[model samples]
Each structure stands twice: as C-alpha cells, then as structure tokens.
Target chain A: MTGDGQSQARPRFEFRRNTWILAAGFLALLCAVNYFLQDNFFEPGVMVSNLTTFTPLILIAIGQTYVILASDIDLSVGAIVSLVNVVTVSIMHHLGGDALAVAAGIGAGVATGLAAGAANGLCVAALRFQPIITTFATGTVFAGLALWILPDAGTVQAPEPVWRTYSASFVGVPFVIWSLGVVALGCWLYSRSRPYLTLMAVGGNIRAAFGSGLPVMRTRIAGYVICGLFCSLGALALTGETATGDPLIGIAFTLSSISAVVLGGTALSGGVGGVLGSVLGAILLGLISNVIFFAGTPFEYQNLIQGVIVLVALAGGVFVSRGGAR
Target chain B: MSAARERTRSGPRWYRHSLVLTLAIIVVLFAAGETLSPGFAAPGQVIYLLVTASLLGFVAAGQNLVILGGREGIDLSVGGMISLGALIAGNVMDASNAAILPALLATLAGTFALGAVNGLGVTFLRIPPLVMTLGMYGVIQGLLIVITRGVPSGRAAPMLSAFVNEPLVLGIPGILFAWAAFAAFVIWMLRSTAFGLRIYAIGANENAAALSGVAIRRTRVLLFALSGMCAGLTGFLVLGFSGNVFIGVGDQYMLPSIIAVVIGGTSLAGGIGGHHGTVAGAIVLVLLQSILTTLNIDPSGRAMIFGGTLLLLMFFYGRQQRLRV
Candidate 1:
C-alpha cells in the first residue's frame, strides 16, 4: 500500500487509481466469453444458481477487505468457517433440529466466530504478535476444536428446511441474491461510518493515525471482528449449501478468500480499496473457474488453469500498484 | 582466530543459550513422557521419534533460510513442492534401483527451478511472496493431478526404504545420518558464507543492504530456490519413508515446517534465528506428537495442545522487537 500510484483527477487517470476496475474489466470479459460458450449462462435459473454458489466467497472477500484495509491479514477465516459450521450442526443435532434449535445454533456459531476474531485482534493489535503466525496458530486451534466437536463428517446437518430456504426464492428473487443485497447495503452503510474511515486511516499510515488521536487499536479490532462475523456468515451459507458438518470443509477457502481479496484490487499491504471491488473480485474469481469449466477444460487441468489465471490477475494489479516502486 | 570462528558460529552468548534452553525443554518433556508411559524413553521409541524429526528437519531447514531472508518471507508452496518432488521421483525411478541417482538430482533441480519461478514472481513481478507461493502451490497441485492421471503410483527402491528405516550404525537410522550431514552444511553456510551475512543484512534493513551493495534480489531468489530444494528433499524422504506416493502427500508438512522454525526461536520477522535450534525444534514437535499419543489424547486434543503451546511460545519469541526510546 506504500508508495503506490499517484492520485489523478481525470476519468482516464481515475481508471488506473482504481485497480478494482481491472477486476471489473476482466469479470466482464470473462462473463462475455462465458455467455457465448454456455447456452444457459444468462438464464434466470442458472444465474440464481451461480449467485448462490459464489455468495459465500463474495461475503468472505468483503470481510477480508476490511482487515486488509487496516493492513492486517486474517488466515483463520477458513478455520472459523469450519468451527462455526460444526458448532451450528452439532448444536442443532443436540437440540433435535427444531426451528428454535436452528436459531440457537446459528447464534452460538456467530458468537463463537466473533470471539475468535476478538482473540485474533487482541493477539495482533494489543499483544503485538505477528499477524500471520498468530492467526496460523489460532487457526490450528480452531480447526482442532472443530474436529473435536464433530469427529465424523456428514453425521449432523441442519434440518431440511434450512437447505430448502437456501434453495428457494422470494418474489422471483433467489434467497442468495437477497442476502447479498443486504450484505452489499450493509457494507455501503459501514463505509460512511466513522469506524470505517478510522480503519482506512490506520491502514494508510498507522503512526499518523495514532498521532491524530484516532482509536487505532479499537478500529483494528473491529476490522478483525467484522471479518470473523462475515466468515461465520459464509459458513452458514456453506452449511445450507452442503447441509452437512465437516471439519475439513474450509481448508480450501482460507487461501481462496485471500485470492479474492487481492484480486478485487485491494492492496495486500492494505488501505486504498473498498469491499465493492472485492465483491466483484470474488465474482470474477468464480467466473474464471466458470469460464474454464465452460471452455471444455478437463477436470484434471482446471486447477492448473485456475492457478495460472489467478496469478495473471494478481500480476494485472501490479502494473498499477507498483508504478511508484519503479 | 578460533575465538572469532566461535563467536560467528554461535553468535552472542545469549543466542547460544536459547539452543540450550530448547534442549532443556526437550529433556523435560521427554522425562514427563517417560513418567507417563514406561517405554517412552526406550532407544527404539526415541529413535523412531528422531527419525520422524529429521523428515521435518529438512523442511524447517529450508523454512529457516526463507524466514531469515525476511520481507514477509514464507513458502506456502513447500507442500506443493514436496508433492511434486515425490511424484517426479516416483515417475523417473519407476521402481528401479539404478535410476535413484538421476531421480535425486532431477527432483532437486526440478523443484529448485519451480522455486526460482516463485522467486521471479515475487521479486521481478513485485508479487507478494505469500501470494506468489500460494498460487504456485495450486499450480503444483494441478501438475500432480495431470502427471498421475488421477491415481498416484510408484514404488521406492528397496535400498531407498532401507536407507530411511534401517540403522546405518550405532542403531541410528541412515536418515538421521543424512540429516546430520545436511544440518552441518546448512549451519556452516549460515555462519561462514558471505551470503549468510547478506541474508541477515537484507532481512534487517533492505534499503540499507541495497545501499551497501548487497544483491538483495538475487540473494532472495537464491534463498527461495534453496527452500524449494529443501522441500524437494522432504518429498524424496517421504517417498522412501512411506515406500510409495500419495496424493497431496506434502500438504501436511506445510504448517509443521513453519512451526518447527518458529519454535526453534527463529524470529518470524527474520534475521534472528538459526537452523541449529530448528533441529531441536523438529525434535520437540515429534516429541509433542508422541507424548500426546501416549497420553491417549486424540489427534484433535494433540493439535489443540500443539497450537496452545505455539501461542505460548510466541509469547516468548517472534514479537516485533520493541525499541526502547
């Protein structure tokens, strides 16, 4: 985030200032290619299905954007998701799967996630443990706890109605879309709040923000807290989609969320980006895989192609972000 | 002249004692495990633990260098490299004893090249080392899938397995001997070589190191490549230890490698840790695993205890050095 591109006022220059635009441009191009390749890409049903599948990533990226905005990284999101998912499902199993049981299970999951985030915040911002290792340690702990709680996978699931609700639509709009709308709206509202600006200032220059009397510590904690909450929410969506509890479920999402965050135009060093681009970034990542799938790539080679493209997207952001470095 | 070498080899007295402290903890923990389980202190069990330790030692050695090189240095692709190395070793040797040397050279050189690409992306392309290696990790996974055509197959030559498991002398496994030689070479390189000082300088202050004419970019790339080679060695070791290959075999080594380095008291911020401590660190981790298993604590509980211990260890080591004004 340090010594990045200079701020420019013109529309053309503004395009360079916003690296998310790169993600957007790529997403559009991919969508176009995908649309031509897949006959049903634009169909309402397929669109709804794709949105539901990708919503969790978008949500996690949004959360990650907050932490990265404050120049901190959370490696524990995937572990938190696993913990929250298992905790939710196990609680539902204990409570006999009633509606009230579902509500309590979700509440417990979210609360547990928030607590984990606060602990990460305390370690990094207060105790001054290095963010990467601290989170790695905590992630191991959280994943361990998840394995303890649900030693066996697929033995517990939220009731059928939960998945039903996730699969169902309201007024011709999918539940996932509505949830995404609320999330996007919430992010927009938070962007206008004092804490959001405080986080931005802290990320842009920590000593300067501290010198300016900003409550840097609290804002940093809040960033991690928000990240934890969103991760838990993403877990909830995952639970609904998979409808089962598995300790190993989140192993892949940890890095994928980081990829989505970086791909969205947010600087890895933090500051100078928004959740909007992250949302697009997450969608862009989803689309890349989608495009690859539609392009008739074999299942074996899909991962290789995805990895190459993700690297390209990262390199794409470099020309703009590294301008000042050169 | 001997005193000067000693000072360079061990650094200040305080740094030397951290190794002693870690060894002391190892002894205390071993004693505790023996008290809990009668056979825990037996040469057989201890040797097995050490055999396990050496496999991880190879990885931590590489991790030790990259972390020492600084700039948020971490090799997320070690797991991938290990898997790739294992697969390549398996395919080239194709169960033949005669091809072992070629397999060894090929695995090291191949993984080092891929690791160099990790370096090129990180330095020349200005990609963050963390993400660059991460993407490479996925790429390696994809490569694994493509090469095996979905099912992993191959066998270690009989001698290779014997080298890993059978005692070479004094009831010591050949792998341990291999580990001792590797550790000595790495320690020598770190203490005696000009590149060692350059690594410390760059980790401490990149701009100042650059201003002082240190080849920061080249050194970092070389360091990453070395880390890759280390992971490649781990893969080779794993193939011998297990007698075959498994999909994603190296994935489990990822966290333990870093944990070994950090627990060895190597600073995560870089420049302040060494491979000597990491040997004890690897032993400490294997001991933890063995002790936890003997206590009848399940894997989850073992993980929790390991993580909890790691957090406590962080309380002692790797915090950003606070300057006293």
Candidate 2:
C-alpha cells in the first residue's frame, strides 16, 4: 500500500498519537484546579454538566478541524451557527413547534451551513480568493441575513421541559456527550482511513496531491461540506441551552473554536491533528473558563488567561518542533 | 542580464497601478454623485471626504507594509488595537491636566505593546499570521470590553479636536497634511532603508530571503510591531476626530483597512505595494461611501455594492496579473 512508506515518513501522526499521553497530566492539573475550587469537583453530575455546557463549542470545533486540516478556514461558522439558531427558532415558532417543524428546522440549519460552506469552497477553489477574506465577507452577509430573518431576539415556543431534558442530559450523561461519541466515531474513521489520508495529503501539498491524481477540489469541497454539517449540529445543540433565538449568539464561537483547534495541537498549516484532539482542546478551554468561574476570577481575567494560554500553547508547539522534542 | 533575475526583482508594473485605477473609479463615482447631488462637489464636502478617508488611509498603509513584507501578513488586530489604545489613552489621561504628550505616549505605548505581542506570536512562535493576529484581535477586544465595562470614558482635549476637525491651508483638511506626512514617511522607509529591502525580499520569496541571510523572523516581528504602532496612532487621531472613543470604532476599521489595501492593488499574497497605492485606495473607498450616502442608497444596497465592487476588483486584479505573463 502507498500508505506504508508514506506513514513511516510522516512524524506528525506519531507526534499526534503520543501527544495524548501528555494530555493526561494537563487533565490532572485541571482536575486538581476543579477540586480545589468548586464544591462539586470530580462529581459525576458536575462532570456531565460541564460536558453539556461545552457540547456546542466542541461540535463546532469538530467541523472547524476539518476545514483547518484541509489547509483552509471558515470564519462564517459562528455566523452560520447564529443564522441556524435564529432560523430554527423562527421556523419552529411559525410552524407551531411540531415534530415536522423541528425536523425542517434542523434540515434548514444543515442547508444553510452547506450553502455557506459551498460559497466558501467556491471562493477558495474556483475564484481562488483567500479563505480568510472570502469567509470574512460571507460571514457578514450570513449574519446580515440572520438579522433580517430574526429582527429581534425572542424565546422559541417549543415545549421547554422536554427539550431541556433531552438537550441537557440522557441516561445521566449529556445528550451532547453521546452525540460526541457519534462524531468521534465518524472523525476516527475519516482521519485514520483513505479519504482523510488523501485530504491530509492534499492539505499538506496541494500540488503534489493533485499530481498524484487525488481529487483536490472535490476533497476540499467535501471537507467544507462536512464542516458545515458539524456546524449545524453545533447550532442545534446551542438551541437547547439558549432556548431563545439570538441572531448574534455565536459571537465568539469562531475564535473560541479556532482556539480549541489550535490548543488541541492541530497544525493550522493543515494535514495534522484530529477531531478527538480538537474535542479535548475544547474541553481544556471549557475547563479553563470553568476554573475561572469557580475561582471567582473576573470574566476579563478569563479572557486574558485564555489569550495567554493561546500564546503559550502556540509557542510551545514551535519550540517542540524545533527542539525535535515532539 | 537574465530575465529571471530581473523579473524576480519586480512584479509586473501594471498590477501595482491598482491604486490609480481604484482612484479613477472613485473619481468617476464621485462625478456621478456630483451630477446626482451638486453638494458633493463643494470644497467643504471634499474636505470632509479627505478627513473621513485619512484614518483608513493610515490603516491601509500599515496593512500594505505588512503584506508587502510577506508571510500572508495582514493585521486583523488593527481595529482591536485602535479601540483598545483609545480606551487606554482616554482612561489614563486626566483631561484636567491636559498633559497631551504624556497621554498620547501612554496610549501609543500600550498599543505598541499589544502589537508587539502579535509580532512575537507570529515571528517567534511560528504561528501563521492569520491565526496569530486573529488571536490577538480576540484578546484585545476582550481586554477593551473589560477595561471599558461596555462604555467608553473620557474625551479628547479641545486643541486636538480642533486640529483634527479644522481645515488647513487652501481649505484642505489638517487630516490631509497628516496623511501626506505618513505616506511620505512610508514611501521613504520602503525606498531607502535596509529594512525595506528585507521586506521586499521576504515578500518576493521567503526562501530566497533566508538563503540571502535575511532575518526573516525579526523582519516579520518588526512589520507586525510597526503595523500596530500605526494603528495606535490612528486611534489617537480617531479620538481627536470623533471627540470620544466608542466600542464599535475598532471593529468598523477592520474591513475598511483590508478593502483599502487590496483595492489599492496591493497583492494579498504580498511583496508588491506602497503607501501611495494604499492612500489612493482609502480615498476611493471613502469616496464610494460618500457617493452612496449622497445617493441615499439603503445600507443593505450599499453593502451589496461594496461587496460586489470588491469581488469585481479582485477579478480584474487577478486577470491583469495573469495577462502580464
């Protein structure tokens, strides 16, 4: 198989696999922080609650990983999430919150995400615009459309208790956590298998990948579509927590998701890192904020600390690679 | 004597003239506005136009410099730095003391420091410019919000305000002098300095620059720091012009700076632009906005037009580059 010689040549995958071992120590530090601060520290219920709170962000980060891994970016994901949430809530209200409306809302969210992703793909692949600029412009347009659709923020008219329970937890674990399993399985299969390998090859060296007869454009477009799907899922999860339609709700989702992706050791250069790493990175960030909350640090301090973490983590990656310590 | 040696030294000339075409487009757009609304042609209105474009002009200059230096270097934190700098300056300066120099220094220093962090991240950390600056943008925005607590405080001294708002000789706005001085400084720096040569070399080809023993990391850091300093200075100017700093001021500048840089015919991929083009680009953008406002176009229609124009410009720029070969 072409994979054998290729796999041996790549130090990145090995680095990625072994990196999780070090995460245990970081996770332990987080546990220690939580224990010292919060009363419910290490409790099963609290852990589950933390998972629930982080669900939407992790979901969005999963999709963001796909795009980032493909050596592209999607700034409109947050805007897409906002658009999806607003649209879903508005549609449910107008359609009387029936099962069909709920289904339609979910479908609409997917469609919106796909359309936005496709636009990004077209800009990147066909128009050859930079991912940053194209996505930035599309983000504004999508957010504007969201505002036009839902001019005001309001609570959705759905039966709250059912959704609250369904969204919050199932069988003592967050429903989002279970959903995480599904996403993890999918991510694992994609990343460890042929299509993902091809994607990584494409991202790592587009010219080489193209010359090797890999469908570069198709793979990239597919990556974006997958990202869009995950973003929709993120939006759906967010609906349960918010219970209201906020056209601007996902304001920092893009930055936070990217932060999570980077912290998870995903190379922004693409073709490195996996969805699981991103998920853990999201959890790390979520816990950092959680620690801040429990420690009574101001929200501003949380942001400052997060910024520091981003800087340190990014710096850490470079130093490791340079020192050959990875 | 080889074509490769010569061709590699300079990019195609016509593509660099995007600023001229951009300016011409704006003039044509303004002429259309004059036909539509005669007030747009008045001296006072034109001065107002110059004043409005000056801040963005400075931002475009900073942006173009970084992009020209290479490594996909664009400052996403320009807006955040502007807002944060203004807030820091306003909060620290005792308006009662009117210690203008110190106040401005403190603000500028803080902004420079914020920008320095961005530089350090991009250069030393090996983070991609897009992500590094983006992270800084988030950090700065968050810090600004926290410091201001969602409401900006303090006001600029009357002297500064008058200087910014009042027109200078020949009915020219004082902002024009400021812009001219800045543009001249940038032009001189790019043409004469070793640093400028490194920026050109790095932008042209990073590998080549490295092979030539250029300090790629240091140049990138300096470029990012300089961009931040320019952004900070513009923040102070913004305060003088607007009389107060507001939360939205920084975010508003982001897209305009980028749009100005690209429309000025500065390649997003870097290594081929100057302050002259950026200034022209900024003027064009300001002119477009003024004409749209005068025509009483709805905001959405205006956005569509702006976005459509940007796409069209990109297309034309792309086509011209392809044609050159």
Candidate 3:
C-alpha cells in the first residue's frame, strides 16, 4: 500500500531508495571502523558509553536537520545550547535543584531556545536577512546573555536521586542512549508524517510549495520550534553528562553537528533526508572522533580529519544529487 | 529594454542609497558625541576611529567579494584565516627575528594558501561554501590552538609596528593610509578588470553568467583567494594594533565584517553591491561602536546594540531589495 501511494504521490522513489541503501551501507562501514578502532566497540558497556557521549551531539543534529531542511541555517544553536546550559545551572543552583526547580530550569531553557529560534526565523522569513549573518548576530547575543547570567563556572547539584542518575546507564545501557533513541524516534516519526512531508516540499521547491498553498511560513515557524526544542533538550543532556556547565562548552559542538548533518547524506539543499540519516551522520562523526582518540591522533590531526570528512561528505552529496550529470 | 531598465534603476534611487543614510547616521553619532564630550570631536579621536575601523573595513571588502560571487559563497573561514595568518606571521617573525618584509610576505602567502584550500574544497571538491568554510574555520582554529599551545603567540616587530603606528600626511593614521590604498586597489579592480566583470555577471546570475561565457568557477576561485588576501592583510593590521598575536584576534571581526558590508549598502542577496559600500559600512560600524564606547556600555551591552542595529538595517534594506525586484 505504501509503495502504491509512494508511486502515486511521487515517481522519485529512486532518490529515497538509493539514499536508504547508501545510509545502511555507510552505517555498516562506521560500525566496522568502530569495531577495529575501539577494543570494546561491540560490547554493550562501550556502546552505552558511546551513546551517552553522543547524545547531545545527536540532539543538536536533529534540530539542525530541520533548519537546514527548511533551506536556512542556524549557527547560533551552539551558543543557544551554551545559554541553556548556563541558565539551567544558575536556576537550579538558586532553586537548590529540587525536582520542580529542575523542570522549571529546563522549561526556561526551552523558552530561551525558542526565543532565539523565533528571532532567527523572523529574520530569515520576515526581515529577509541572510540566515548566516542574522544567526551569527543573535548567537552572540545569546552567548553574551549566557555569560552575563553565569560569569563563572558553578555547580547545579541535583538533590533528587532520579535527577542525579539522569545520565546513568541501566543494564549497561546509558539513560542518555535511551533519551536519544526516544528523541530520534520522535523525529523519525515526524519526518514520515504529513506535516514534515509538507515541510520537505516547501524546502524542496519553495515556489511550487507556495503555489500549492502549503502554509510555508507556518511550516517554517514549526521547523524552528522543533529545532529550538531539540537544542534545549540537548542542553539538558549536556548538563546531565558534565554535571557542571561552562558557557563556552557549546562552541565546538557547532561545527561537529553541522558536519554530521551534511555527512549523513542529507541534502544541504533540504527536503531530501530523514532523522535516521542525521543519527547515522552523528554516529559516523562520533565514531571518527573515537577512532582518533584510540589511535592517539593529536588534537590538530583530529580536527583535520573532521574537516576532511565534512568536505568529502559534502562533495559526495553534491555528486550524488547531480547524478554525475555535471 | 533600456527604457524599462532605466525605470527599474530610477525606482531604486531615493531609498536604495543606504550608504547615504548610514553616513547620516554616522554624522549624527559623531555630532552627538561632540555635543556630549567635546574631547571626542577632537582630530585625535577621529583618527583613532579611522585606525580602528580599518581592520574590519579591509576584511569587509574581502567578504563583499565572496558574497557577491553569489552561489552561497562566503568565507566563514576569513576570520580563521586572519587569526591563522597572524599567528604564522608571529611565529615566523619571532621576537628576535622581527624581519618586517619577510614576515609580511610569509603571512600573506600562508593566508593566501589557506584561502586557496577553501576555494579548492568548494570548486574542485564541490563542497558547499558554507559547509566547506565552516569546517575549515574549525580546522584552522584547532591548528592555531595546537601551534600556540593556547597562548598568545608572536610579538609585532617594533619597527614595523611603529611604522604602521605612524600618522600619514594630514595627521591621518598610517593604518588609514593602508586602508585607503587597499580600497583604491579594490575599487580599481572592480572598475577596470575583466575579473570584476566576471564577478558581477556570476553574482547576478550564475547560469546566465555561464551562458554568457563567463568562467564562473574561475571567478569564484579568484574571489575566495582575494578574500583570503584581504584577511591576510587585515591580520598584519591586527598585529600592529594588538602588538601581539592572540588566539582571538580574528574573533570580533567576523560579525563586524559582515555588518560593515551590509551597512555600506552592499546587498547580502549578492551581485548588487561593491567594496565602496563596504568601506562606508565599515566606517559606520566603527562609528556606531565608538558611540557605544563613549556611552561606557559594557561589551555585552554593546554586542546587543550592534545586533539590534544589524537586524533593523537588514530588515529595511531587505524590504527595499524585495520591492525593487
């Protein structure tokens, strides 16, 4: 029935079909590499550790996929994450990390993320500012606000055992892994849903999508809201893992997240990839870094490898899209 | 067709000239400063403003070249190149071996090569400029960190600094002289060269440009390289200003570079603006910062103000562009 609908809806199962195959093949490659690089890569214990470490990045990539799929970009997600991290710590510190207070902190953090995302959306969709420049400016503002609120490092010691064990593993499976799995599953479901299909059409061809009366602006606003929510959740996961917050910690994640999204076969042009692709992308990146860690690669070489991966991935994406016609 | 074109051009006459408006804003800012503190109106402060704005001014010029190349072309790596360039120059011309010309040339070459790598990644490797530049930025930053071991590296040659520090004829800062010379070169290139025409055509519509026999790829590559050159020269200026090469020398220039270009009335939509507007935009940006500094606002507050101004200008200018189209 889905295949019949797919044919009726669009003749381009070729794109999706090929992309799925590519993603699976890439995942296999990554797993194999991870096996050889890390001694316990296949073990549940190491897998759990990798999942916990990869959670925040995966979360950020999930949000970024939406923004990029909308044909706009958000450079400020890292800064927004930093802001959330700092704010959550400060709020929790003041509220003594009570259960209610933790919820409030996360809520406030999500609110800030939405505000930043809304500002970017308005700038891009309304004011017509280039996403790169507008987001850059707002990123600075958010980061500045973060610094202002928490000028120095501090602790947000959760009083509740449940909260304290947020990052803990169960049966050798990290809680972060579970959380990421849930978020990833939600995103995958959304991507397959009608709303996300409409979003994809909008990004795929704005003029056509607009002519179809798809409520492009509303879709864009929703995309940003989703991005904001994911970023906030990523911030929470970051806080759980680190126990302490630094306003500057989110800086490095920005490049890594972008690299992951692009590497995972998502068309930078948008409307072409799913959250599973992004998760694979994040995992691929995480594994690459893990390889570097195991191989005793210097920090600079690791950075170089990341730069190479993004370039190669981008080149691959462009090549695939053009179908070598160029 | 010409008549229709003329009508199109004339329609954008009054409101499209935002450089004039930005100039007005600068004048008002300066006048407000004068009224508030007569000391600020002194020639010294004006000279200082010119000097301080030059770095961003030059970088903005480079950014305009890339932005105008149109196909989502921007050197996010420009800021990183500036830092990397400065660091290389610093390392090469260590405190004992402060050979000026060698240091300058070496830094220029190093930055140019870095910029070329970005160009290669985009043009040859077919990476999107945004992804390519973003990744390169990180790689460059990490490399710099490794090289410097997270500390400020290299001292500016005192003689070179002094020369750069020296005022030119009419008491203008020597940095202003360098800025003017570079701007003159860019403006001349824009007006008198085949490369400039190609850039304009490519930016206007890459498909049309390709159809018209413009070497789209070559033009893009050139623009990226030129952007690198601009960042390199700006690195030298940064060293002179700071007297030491720090990891963050390129940090503040990134936003200001883009803002300067846009404020100077260059369109972010590409193919519509020039280096002249970027120079004006740079002056406007510096003036805005100067006014904020005069107000004694905290850096964070100043950042907020700067962002607010950018959003307002972008909104206004973007509307104008849309209306024209």
In terms of lDDT, the best-performing candidate is 1
Q: Candidate 1, which segments miss by more than 4 Å at Cα?
A: A1-17, A323-325, B1-17, B322-325
How far does residue B154 in candidate 1 sit from its true spot (Å)?
2.0
The CA lDDT at A248 in model 1 is 80
What Cα-based lDDT does every candidate model obtain?
0.84, 0.74, 0.73
Worst 10 residues of 2 chain B by lDDT: B316-325
**Scored by Cα lDDT, where does model 3 land?**
0.73
DockQ per candidate, 2 decimals: 0.47, 0.31, 0.34
Name every residue pair that clashes in candidate 1: none
True contacts kept of each: 0.54, 0.16, 0.33
Q: Per-residue alpha-carbon lDDT of model 1 for B155-222, expressed as tens digits?
A: 78777888888888999989998999999998888778888777777776677677778888899999
lDDT (10s digit) by residue, model 1, range A1-326: 22213232334545534767777888889989999999889998898889888988888888888988898999888888899999998998799888998999899989988998999898888777878888888988998999999998998878887899889889988889888888878988998998888998888777778888888788889999999999889999999999999988887788989888777777776666778778888888899989998899999899888888988887666544433224
Off by over 4 Å in 3: A1-13, A16-27, A155-163, A169-173, A321-325, B1-16, B34-38, B95-98, B145-152, B319-325
What's model 3's lDDT at B62? Answer: 87
- How many Å off is the CA of A151 in candidate 2? 1.6
Candidate 2 segments exceeding 4 Å error:
A1-13, A16-25, A155-162, A168-173, A298-300, A317-326, B1-11, B32-42, B91-93, B96-98, B142-151, B288-305, B318-325
Instruction: Assess the local accuracy of residue B195 in candidate 3 as a C-alpha lDDT between 0 and 100.
Output: 78
Please tell me which model should have the higher DockQ, number 1 or number 3.
1
Tell me the tens digit of each residue's lDDT in model 3 across A120-192.
7777776657677777777777777777777666544434543467756678766776786687678768867
